[model samples]
Target: MISTTDIIISICYIAFIVALGFWAGLSGKKDGAAAGEYFLAGKSLKWPMIGMALFATNISCLHLVSLAQSGFDTGLLAGNFEWMAAFTLILLALFFIPFYIRSGVATLPDFLERRYNRACRDWLAVVSVVSAVVIHIAFSFLAGGIVLETLFGINMFTSIIAIALVTGAYTIVGGLRAVVVTEAVQTIVLLTGAVIITVLSWWKVGGWQPVMQVLQDGGQLDKLSMLHSSGDPSGLPWYAVFLGYPVIGIWYWCADQTIVQRVLGAKDENHARTGALFCGFIKVLPVFIFILPGLLAYVLYKQGHLDLEVLRQADGQLHTKGIYSVMITKLVPPGLVGVLVAALLSGLMSQISGALNSIATLVSYDLYKRNRPEATDQQLVKTGRIAAVLALLLSIGLLPLLNRYESLFNGINDVISHIAPPITCVFLLGVFWKKASSQAAQYTLWIGSALGAGVYLLGKLYPINIPPLMVAFYLFVVCVVLQVMLSFAFPMQHTAESNRLYWESPLAPLRVKGWPGLANYKVLSTVLLLMMAVLYWVFR
Candidate 1:
């Protein structure tokens, strides 16, 4: 049970967060509804804010709970999701951000409209908004609700509503700037709490070596390995890691509006690239900060301090899901529990706010203003705020469906695997292939989405043991083939605007001088690659 002191500290933290969000809202208000100010933070975010906001937005409670549980179940291999993201982020900084900035589009859909057609833009916007509300925002609220219910005996619905209200209060008023600035603060809280948890866990386990020794003694050495055989159906296989994971990573790191929006808010290419690189570096922390803590909890379970039934399945595997909350309830002291709860809330709120703000941006710019081209800046902002509220309501309404999933992390990944391939195919081909006509784009989306949905349904209906990542890779390949076939048959009927959206058509790639001779982005990219290589090597 939560002590009074813990309750009070948590309340205080919530109040402080609300106040910070309001301050940011006020700053945004001063800009007077300029779409750029509200949606993209006036395109003036520095590298630090951009980096922190991106990291915080991406590392939500879903990650904290799900990733930790995954580590408990599968060991370090689950961290491949976090570590492999570096490659995609580097690719984003190197190849995508420049074109995105040069196009001067507010939303990802807006960029699609520029590169492809208005129909493509509209289709993407609808898909994006629906996904944000249904998947991202709803799942975030569910995670927060689970935490609150588990810790404080709060009703899950009540917790969801409370979290929605607190997050929406700032997001509706302040927009992206408020979300980003407050997220920077939340990132600090999250990391601090995670570090404390990790350190305490390490101590409890009698250090890393003992933890490894215990797992080995238990004949669970497979859990210690990051790489698994293709025939090993238990954890992530090598084929999925190499081919499938990158497809999901590309869509998530490079193409997702919730993530790319922060990079879009950067002042210039240098700041954007720097922020992406910084976020890439930060992405590597989950294995230690979040996942290792889960591993520690498993250690405690093995040591008999924790109830085996709470964290283990009937099949003798770790349940992994709900293990993080179990760890907190069983392990953390009172005041620190309050702080860690706040950190968990911070993660949830940041992602919710980011999703809310991005949804708002999409509706305001892509859907609203398209019909009312002469709409004032204030009008767009109002629409965005209204859209955010509606999205929140929709998310709350969908909360009941969340209980069906055994693992929130797996649920999210499954959803992403199904939805991401079509959009990823569109964006990748749209940016690189000059002849990727609007017809091809439209058909690919239709065909790819159909294929993805079919795959998902088949998996649900049958005993399809293929990982979602591998399924996504197959879908992506099919989509790419469809795009190429259609593009060649019907040549692109490009207009003046469409012609200039490519990499070298009119907007040249941004070149930067490094400290010595190489480009700065290249240097950072190399560092990120090296770090990833070292991590995999050590873990493998």
Candidate 2:
């Protein structure tokens, strides 16, 4: 059950978030403003805000709970999800940022139309909108409900509604500026809380040496091993770690709007690149803060220092059974519990607001006005706010359904893994492959979606015992390969037409200005390669 202190702290945090929305929402009354100001914060974000926004948006309740659970169950293998993210983030800063900014678009879908055609743009927009509704927003509500139940002693349905209403309140009012600014504050809270919990866990365990002893006794000492262990069930096989994780990470950091919007909001290209690199550097620390608690929880369990039986009820099941962060509450004192709960809420609010805002941007610019160019800016903004509210309702309704999944993290991972391949494929082709046509783009989207969904359903139905990660990895590879084959087999005579229709405007693409140092691509690639080598050496 949640203590009174935790509820007080949570309520205060919500109030602070509402205040931020008030500050940002005041700007909504400005007349004759460009969409840039509303959707992208007038492209005026600085490096610091960018970093926090990225961190806050990316580290949601999933990390607080599911990641901790993973560490508790599987030990160190979960760290790969964090440390490997650094490389992909750097890759995004280098290879993708320039193109995204140079396109001068309000949303990723707008870029798709500029690169492919209206059909391609519409296809991506539809997929993205649906995914936001069903997967991203819905899962976040589910995660928030879990947080509430664990910390507030409330039913999941009531908690879901409460969380959604709170988050959506600020999001609808404040828009992008509200999301980013609040994210900045929340990021600090999240980091401080996580670090505090880790430190306390160490001290309570009688320092590192005793902690190690406890972990070793519990058969969890090797949890820090980065490489797959032959004896381990959850470990990613060696091949999958290198190829699979990278692609998935790239798909997330580079193409996913929730992340890219942070970079896109940067005041300039340099800030965008700098902000991304900074976040990339910070990505390496999750192992210590998020995953280690699980190992520590296992240790506490082994020593009988913590009572799991008491932690459960008549069912012989733990409260918040699959939530990893809940372990910390049982181990920590009241004041510290308030801080960590605030941090968890911080992460949750950031993701919720970001998704709500991004979906609005897409709806307003890509779908709402695409066929109705006569709509005024005020009208579009009104529609955008409505979309935000509707998105929250969808999330609120889906939260309970999500709680039935085996692992909250696994449920989120499955959706992203399945959706990413096709989206990544078409976006990559649209940008770099001069020969890629609207027809080819459409075909690839269908083929990739089918291939990815088919593999997922097959693995589930057949009980193949293969990792879902493996299935998703192979599915994407096949789609990309077959897309290439099919494109060549039915190559059309639209080279000049494709170039005319799809090529980014020369001035727009070349708008980037700076005394170029090491190309971001070279710097990012080199750094990631070195980091991978070091990680492999350690893991090996």
Candidate 3:
């Protein structure tokens, strides 16, 4: 049970977050209350805020709960999800951000229209909005609801409503500025709380050696290994990690609106790339702060300090869900419990608000303004606010349905793997392949969506048993082949404007001198790459 002190602390944390959000929103109003200020923070976000907001948005309640559960169930392999993001984030900073900024598009769909056609833009906007509501927002609500239900004994429905109201309150009022400002604060709270849990859990397990010794004694040493065999059913296989994970990572890190929107709101190219690099560095923390704590939880359970009965099935096997909650309830002290709960709630709110803001941007700019091109700045901002509220309502309505899934992490990954391949194809080809006609882009989207739906439905109806990761890889290959064929058959005439949008366009001289050495982007990119390599080496 939560003590009086813990309850007070948690309530205070929530109130402070809401108040901060409102303050940020009101500050944004001072800047003109225009669509640019509201939707993209007037393109004035610096590297620090951009980095923190990106990290906070990505590390949602799903990462806290589901990723921890993954560590508990499948071991160190879960760390790959956090660490491998380094590569994709670097790609975003070095390659994608320049083009996006040069194109001067507000949303990713807007970029598609500038590169291809309005038809391509419209299709992508529709898909993006739907995915944001159904997958991103809904999953956030579900994860937050699960945490509240397990810890505070709050019912899922009530938890979802409470979280939605708190998150949407700030997002609908303040827009991107409020989301970024609040996320920057939440990032600090999340890291501090996670660090506390990690340190305390490690101390409880009598340190690293003892934890390793317990796993070794239990004949579970493979749990410490980062790479697993293809035949290893308990952990992620190497094949999936190599061929499939990047597909999902590209869509998430480079192409997704919720993430890219942060970079889009950057003050300039240097800030955008710098912020992405900073976020990449921050990404390394999850393996230690989040996953390791879960491993520590498993160790504590083995040491008989934690009750495993509630986390066990009738077959005497461990069930991974609710492991994080169990760890907190059994191990953390009262006031500190409030801190960790605040951290978890921070993750939840960050993701929901980011999604809400991105959805508003997508609908208001990409869809509504397309029909009403002469709409005033105030009118566009109003449309975005209305769209945000509607999206929140739809997301809350979908929360109960999320209970049907056994594992929140797996459900999220499966949905992304199923739907992401086509979108990834479109973005990759649209940016790189000059010959990729608008017609080819359209065909690829339609065909890829149809193929993905068929594969997902067929897998569900029958016992296909293929890993969703591998399925994602296969789908990507097919889309690539189709795009190449269609583009060659019906190529579009390229112009100077279209050529400028590509990577090698005349946005030169590309090199900018940094403080006493090489270019800033190159320096940061090299550091991020080296860090990623060292992490994989150490963990592997």
Candidate 4:
């Protein structure tokens, strides 16, 4: 159990985040009430802030907890999610960032509308808002509530309510500026705490050699493998990862509004590209700091250094959601528990704040302001604040539902697998194929979404034998074929503006001159790719 000191530290840390968030908001106030300032941080964010915010916003309390659970349950098998993301982030840096910066759209839906049609934009805006609420905000709240309940014995609902109010307050007032500013700080704290715990766990385990010996003796040495063979229990083989990951990865890392909003707030194209590549580099850390700890926890458990009875139910089935929490109490000392709780909250509220801001932006810009073109910036900002509160309430109510899945990471991704196929299909086609028609996009999104929903429900009612990643890949292929047929049926009459958006050829996006030396996006992207490849090789 956490001591009084831990509670005080957590409360103080929350207060600091609130104060800092408010400060960021007020400072941004002087920049004027323009939509650009409130929604996109006045388009003045540098690469460092953008990169850290991207990392922070994506690394929620859910990731910290669920990834550990995944680590304990499946070993290095789940690390593919962390590692495969590097490819998508590189795609974002090289291909997607240029268009996002040049287009100056506030949301990804707006990007779609410009690239496709208003119908595409409207469909995507609704999907974006819902996904941000469900995927980003609700999942984070559930994780936060779970952590609070575990360490301090607080009620999950009470914890969720408190966190939502605190995070939403700053998100409403400070907008993206406040969100990113606090996210940057949270990223640092999160990484520091993770590193500390990982180092401590490693030291306690008597170095990695002992861990290897334990696994080998236990006949669980395959736990160290990153890529699984066909028929592996994890259901994630190398082929599945390669084919399936890109389908959802592109949608999440490259196309999602919640993650990509930071890129949109960049000072310029170079900053946007470099920031995304920087985030790709940071992506290499989660496998070690987040997932490795869980692997270490398994090692400790086998060695009788930790107990996980709390993670089991009366029926004797393991939930594993509480693995990371159990590890925190068992592994770390007393006073540092406060810092760790603060770090959990850091992941929690940073994700909430970022997602809430993006939801507000999508609501105000895509849904509200587009209809009321003459609306003032003050009015747009007001609408956003209201939207943030509503989104928070909806997310809070969704906690029980979100908690149903045994694995939080897989649950979120399962939903993503269903949702991302059509969007990914549309985006890939829209950006790469000039012949991709607005008509094709409209029909593809509609028919493809219906198909995805049907497939998802089918899997739930009578489980689909295929892994979720393969499902996503197959769904994407269907959408691609559907769109291509639709495009041929209804040829595009591209506007001059839409024509400028897509590359004429595969090499077109790379033709533009990047910055000099190491900062060049091309240089950064290449290095990131090589680094990821080497890591994969080592792990394999």
The root-mean-square deviation over C-alpha atoms between each candidate and the true structure, in angstroms, is: 2.3, 3.4, 2.0, 1.0
lDDT of 4 by residue, 1-540 (tens): 778887898899999999999999778865455678888999999999999999999999999999888888888778889888889998898788888899888899988888889999999989889999999999888888888898878899998898888888888998999999999999998998898789988988999899999899988887888898888878788889999999999999888889999999999999898888888889889989999899999999889898888888999986689888998899989878888888899999999998888988999999998899999888998899899999999988888888988889989989999999999999999999989999999999999889999999889899867889999999999999999999999999988889989888888888989899999988888888899889889989
Q: How close is candidate 1 to the true structure, as a TM-score?
A: 0.95
The digit string of per-residue lDDT tens for model 2 on 1-540 reads 657887687788889888977687566445567466668887888877887788888888767787777776777777777788887777666557776776667778777776666877787777777777766678877776776776667887787777788888878777788889889999889989888878876676777787778767766666667777443577376566666776567767887776788888888777787788778767777778888876777666767776666446687766534445455567778767777888888878888889888898889888999988998877787888999888888767666666767677777777777778777776666555656656677788877877777766775677566555665577667757766766676564554334543335433433445425654534544676687678757855
Give one digit per residue, the lDDT tens place, for model 1 in 145-208. 7778878788989988988899899888888888998999999999998998888888878887
For all candidates in order, the CA lDDT equals 0.85, 0.73, 0.85, 0.90
* Model 1, residue 125: C-alpha shift (Å): 0.4
Leading candidate by TM-score: 4
Give lDDT: candidate 1, residue 528. Answer: 89
Of 3 and 4, the candidate ahead on TM-score is 4
Error of 4 at 204 (Å): 1.3
- Candidate number that wins on TM-score, 2 or 4: 4
Model 4 bad stretches (over 4 Å)? none
Regions of candidate 2 where Cα sits further than 4 Å from its true position:
28-30, 229-231, 310-325, 490-536
TM-score of each: 0.95, 0.91, 0.96, 0.99
Q: Candidate 3 residues 490-522, lDDT tens each?
A: 888776677666655433324545334543878
Error of 1 at 36 (Å): 2.0
Candidate order by decreasing lDDT: 4, 3, 1, 2
10 residues in a row with least lDDT, candidate 1: 506-515
Worst 10 residues of 2 by lDDT: 501-510
